[model samples]
Target: MLIGELAEQAGTSTRMLRYYEAHGLVRPERTANGYRCYDEAELRVVREIRGLLAVGLGLDDIRPFVACLRAGNPSGDACPDSVAVLRRKLAEVDDYIDQLGAVRRQLQTQLAHAITVRPR
Candidate 1:
C-alpha cells in the first residue's frame, strides 16, 4: 500500500505518518519517482504508534516499541525496552492519580465547610 492508504486504514492523517517517518519511527521506501511506498506490515506499525501517542507517550518513548515490532515481534511491547517504558508510564499515571485524589479531598473538605457555614 501507499502512504495515503496506510493513513486511511490506520485512522490517522498522512501528515502524521510523514511526521512519524521524519522522527524515524516509521520508515517507508521511496518509489522511482520519489513517492513514498509502504509495506502492508506498516499498517500494524502505524496503528501501534497511534495507540501509544493517544496514551500520552511521546515519539521518543515509542521508539523501542516500534523497534520491537520491526524486529519481528507480534506485539510492540514484547521487548524489554518496551516493557520498561510501560512500567515507567504506569508509575507516572499512578502519581497523577494520587495527586488528583489529594485535590479531590481538599475540594470535598471546602464544600463541607461552605455548606455548614452558609446553610440556607
Candidate 2:
C-alpha cells in the first residue's frame, strides 16, 4: 500500500511514517514512480515502533530493538544485549515514576495546606 493507506491502516499520520523512515526505524520500498510503498510487514513494524515510542523509549534505544526484532529474534528479550537495554530502560522508567510520585504527593500536600489556610 501507499504511505497514506499505510498510515490510515496503522492509525498514524503519513508525516509520522516519514519521520520514522528518516529515523531509520521503518523502511518502505520506493515504487518506480517514486511513491513510497509499504508491505504488511512494514505496517507491523510501524505499529511496534509507535508502541515503543508510547512507552517513552527513545528512538536511539528503539532502533537496536527493532533491528533485532527484524533480524528474526522473535522477541527483544531473546537478544542478551537487547535484554540489557530493556532492563536499563525499565530502571529509568521506575526511577522517573518514583520521582513523579514524590512530586505529586508534595504538590497535593501543599495544595491541602493552602486550602486550609485560605478560604476560596
Relative to the true structure, how large is the alpha-carbon lDDT of every model? 0.94, 0.86
Off by over 4 Å in 1: none
List model 2 lDDT by residue over 1-120, tens digit each. 999999999999999999999988889899999999999878778887778788888888787777777887765446776677789998998999999999999999999999899976
RMSD of 1: 1.1
Q: Quick one: best lDDT, which candidate?
A: 1
TM-score of each: 0.96, 0.78
**CA deviation > 4 Å runs, candidate 2:** 101-120
lDDT per residue as tens, model 1, 1-120: 788898999999999999999999988989999989999778889999999999999999999999999999999999999999999999999999999999999999999999899966
